[model samples]
Target: MRPPVEVCVFLLSLLAPGVLYTLNNVPALQEPLPILGIGMVVLGSLLLLLLFIVRHKTTLDPLFYVFAEFSFTCLVGLTNALEQDGFISNFMGFYLKKGEPHLSTAYAVMMSYWEGVVHFVLFLTMIRRMFTRKSYRSLGLLWAGSSIAHQLVHVPGVVIGKYGSSLRPAFWRNVPFFLVPFWAAFLLFSRPRETPIVTADKIASEQKKSLLSRPVDLLLSLLLLGAAAFSAFRGFVVLDCPLDTCFTYIYQYEPYLKDPVGFPRVMMLAYLFYALPLLAVMLCGLNTPGCSWMLDWTLFFAGAMAQAQWCHIGASLHSRTPFTYRVPADKWWPVIGLNVLLAAAPALLALRCHARPAYFMKPVPKGEANHKKKKN
Candidate 1:
């Protein structure tokens, strides 16, 4: 049987860039735009492969994978949009010479809007699945706060930009709140499900008797805790650094300052935070059924990190006029080697987990009975 429409949409997004080259005017392959386009296509293909596996077998919660894909697609679309819109100039050199709008901007924006709709639907599903009425009500309040902040930061840009005014501050302000639904989804999924009373009692007794218990659960708990700590530190402390001293600070100069680092940082950080929890949950034995969720996140982070290195770090290192202070051009291999290793490790781990049966046996939720019927 084929996967759902949502899964197909995500797969198409990943493949769209390469397909676009064949279908529309192919952009130059040597530039970052083509590279990014190809990267998305590859990532989406990997995810679709995993989704196919889950659809054919296993009983894991389908919505989890759907929601995860939604988050990942949003992230990828946002990344592409930011780059196509010339936001990445602060961190990387453009392949095209000055004075041309990126051909891919419209495609990126359309994908981003669809991503937002999917993301909101995913949030609603999570709320229904994990939260009781009272808990969801509390979560709703938090969502409202984040939504307000997000709009305050982003809506003005949309409004003012229509009137020929710059609203950069609005975009910056919205960053922190943009992922509130994502974070809420993470917290909702992290809670332990209610097991049979007998099984619960047995596990409780085992826990009291032995320190070594539920290795996956232990690791998951630690990861979640660590991610939470890291996020808190980043928000309250790391961002405290003055605008002139941040890692991407060099880009704030007159010529390069046309692009701001705030939006990219916010987008990347939110994606990383959202992904970490899902990874933790899967690692903790949440039966993902397929590797699509894993693949989605792997690509999302890999793409973001690549952009950071190429644009953020690389750009800063060469920001000097006339591009001075270089070792041999041949030394570029070392950086490539490091990136390959970093991207490969998680993908290998995901493949290994996918090959095993222990992690793919989660039961489907009762609410998704119709979805199951449709699949059958």
Candidate 2:
């Protein structure tokens, strides 16, 4: 049998960047309205492609069209980052200028890189997993969390930032960015999770250990505490906390939090409201037995942290940001180092949760264990 239609669409979608590059010079698309027109054209093309495949009697897996659409965006993201960095010119200039002007910011550039490089690889891997008939739930959750984090901050940032007044017809294209992740998360979470196979004896033995006994867990707990504290500090800083430390840190350490673009401030608050509490719960999960939720949630948080930190750091240092808002030269390492650690903590925690999941596994009752053993 021939390869699936998805495989063909994937190959065809690689033409997006080149096509866009050629279109950049087209005078017809020079105006702001062309962005909306371009969006419509893309939508039409995708619909046509889908209809063609259906006519050929190919079975489409759930989210087949979504994946096809994202395949095109992956290449576009690379082009966006390249155009922003000046390695390529005019590729996304029109989009940046009128489509979503906020994308010209340093934070958006870094986010573009994440979406281009990291998320592109993830989409490819997920596609491979789907075609291979493997369980991709864990990977799906990671992508969902990361994509949701981007939309949550980005959409709001644009609405409140200086760009809010300048939003063009093309800006509405972000509607899918906001809706798809939540929908994907809903779908992924609704699927029955594949349970980790581990014995009750192993679960008990692992969970019985104290925090001090597990050196890695202890380290992660301390780091989580530090991250939580940092989140609170930044959250306060953004809220105009009257304290001297908050004032000093905002002006001297990370003035990016005060940028009129509003992305950094929103990101800090998100960490405080969502990530901080989750970290506390995860810390508890580290200490408490039978917190099976840690396995998936940890991965989700890791993806969010990774995406948020990447954008935050890039925005903080990007030349596009005003000098006053960028990290002070004297305080660069401390700010970046802390952010790096924040990104790393969740990743390490996720790995630990997956590596030896028995610690987090729900303990089987003695009777249940005996019955299962007898049946075996």
Candidate 3:
């Protein structure tokens, strides 16, 4: 066994800023067309570097390549966040101007921070797990959910929002960002779940308990319902519902939902149609016997909510947002507190399932259960 090839990937990600500085200085490279070409060259260089590392000392899991590439992209995303905040100059300005102008918006700025920071840390952690020969299945599921939710909102939002009219050739560079996560997700879900070992009696006793008996589950059920209701309310607020409550809530509670950038609007609707129903099913998972599915799905849902909430909250308060659209000072606590509650429910539910999963485990066969009892 030799040193892992992925160590190089980590190093390259750290070196990204210097590389961007060098690229930024090239006058010709400042143009969008040249910048796009530079992207291809950089990608090709990374692929060649990967191949070389593979030939030397690599486990060479296909996912290793996917994650390595994605981790590098995280560095780029971080650079975007830095540039958008004016902490860095010349690094991403050219690309920001023509490649993807939507990124200049407050929602996009916050999204860049989430991707650059949260998602970057996640990808790197998963890669480290792979290097250590540990089970990354759960983390992979988390990253997959986060990445897919990001693309589902981001790509479509850019294409259809106010920025749609200024579409440039460099915009297509997001193709991999849009497509690779779905592929990675399919691969991750296909892998066998690495379940924890537990005695049959433990599973039996846990599964035998009703929802009412578990105070935590009962409490979480109520919260999940509240989260679902909030999701629906925000969806209606974004859609410009006729209800006076919706109108007041939009203006006073979350005017960011009406931002021209479109990402916030799409995000609220996603909470409505996709995340809302899942909350109900998740409630069922808490009460139902033998719902092993909850373990994986809840982890996935938790990741999405975490990312979604981080971006939504940050963007809503970010200075880039028009002051009029920003969260009002008078109603800040109620609005932020409600959003925080909804965001926390999935995480609590996931932690509950994963921390002590016996209740959600499949029941052992009667014969097997008897044998285990006798053996014990």
Candidate 4:
């Protein structure tokens, strides 16, 4: 199979069931389908695990994969619980059917919040790894501090619930999700200016001579920038109706979404605002002799896109429809078209820029020569 086709199959195996649950109405498929869907997701995740093991011989960022897997599991578990309880009878119908209280709801909510926390930790780690030692240390402290504050809120919530208190802690326990971007903004704003590592003279005279040179590098950087911007914008803005009161109700009804509008908006703005500085660092590192900064950035970008899609699906559940927003048959064609383009663009761009091949190369100098010597 073609690489693109393989990737599509992999993604569809993970995403199709959730999408179907959200956009269809088939009773027999309601409960069993999510189980089957989650099975596929687990299969895909295992495949990722195998790939990581065989290739990296260590691990993909554990933080990224763990949070992603937990998110999928929670989603599937929630759907199954809701369906069995008859809260969701058919795809389009919702009615409260009381039964023995299930701890799955609380578990699912806690997992969801932790997923956000893990995401913040992952990004902060990525930024730290990409920058200087001093910057890394400073950001590490900030991440640790924010994490403590976030969990402090959760402690009261957990304790109060256990003590038979009717009052629940505020939903702002999830605010760390947005606070991450705010901290990133502070880092960006306070960062000192620096001169470009590659001089115009070098680019004009030497670096532009070959296909694998400065121009190609610049193009790849721009593509990465564009992909990141598109993903962030879609995540923060496009998926929701701007004027819908549902936005307010999401925070009011779902304790998780409280203070939704302002935080997300601020986070999104911070992401956009920091893009240039981050891109500059990426480009500088890419231009260095032995650095694989481009590949690192691409991985971060792809992970962010996946996280955004997950968030989009999760937030959609907060709507009045609550998982029965159907896409018309006619609309499917366009939606599929858009999804295809969105998924394809990043893969193609990565391939064209040789980013993936470079990623598979060992990070140490003379890595290939050393391997051959050991083999001999």
TM-score of candidate 3 versus the correct structure, residues matched by position: 0.94
Per-prediction TM-score: 0.30, 0.93, 0.94, 0.35
- Tens-digit lDDT track of model 2 for 167-273: 88888888986898899888888888777556678778998898889999899999999989988889999999999999999988989999999898888889889
Give the per-residue lDDT digits (tens) of candidate 1, residues 28-88: 5434445445545654665676576456544555434444444444554454445555564
Predicted structure with the largest TM-score when compared to the true one = 3
* Local accuracy by lDDT, each model: 0.38, 0.83, 0.84, 0.39
Give the range of the ten consecutive residues with the poorest summed lDDT in model 1.
Answer: 91-100
Query: Residue 198's C-alpha lDDT in candidate 3?
Result: 71
Q: Point out the higher-scoring one by TM-score: 2 or 4.
A: 2
Tens digit per residue, CA lDDT, model 3, 37-108: 888888778878877777755345688878878778778878878888889777776677657788788778
lDDT tens digits, residue span 185-236, model 4: 3544345522123323333344334436546656665665664655454344
lDDT of 3: 0.84
Q: Candidates ranked by lDDT, best first? A: 3, 2, 4, 1
Q: Where does candidate 3 clash, by residue pair?
A: none
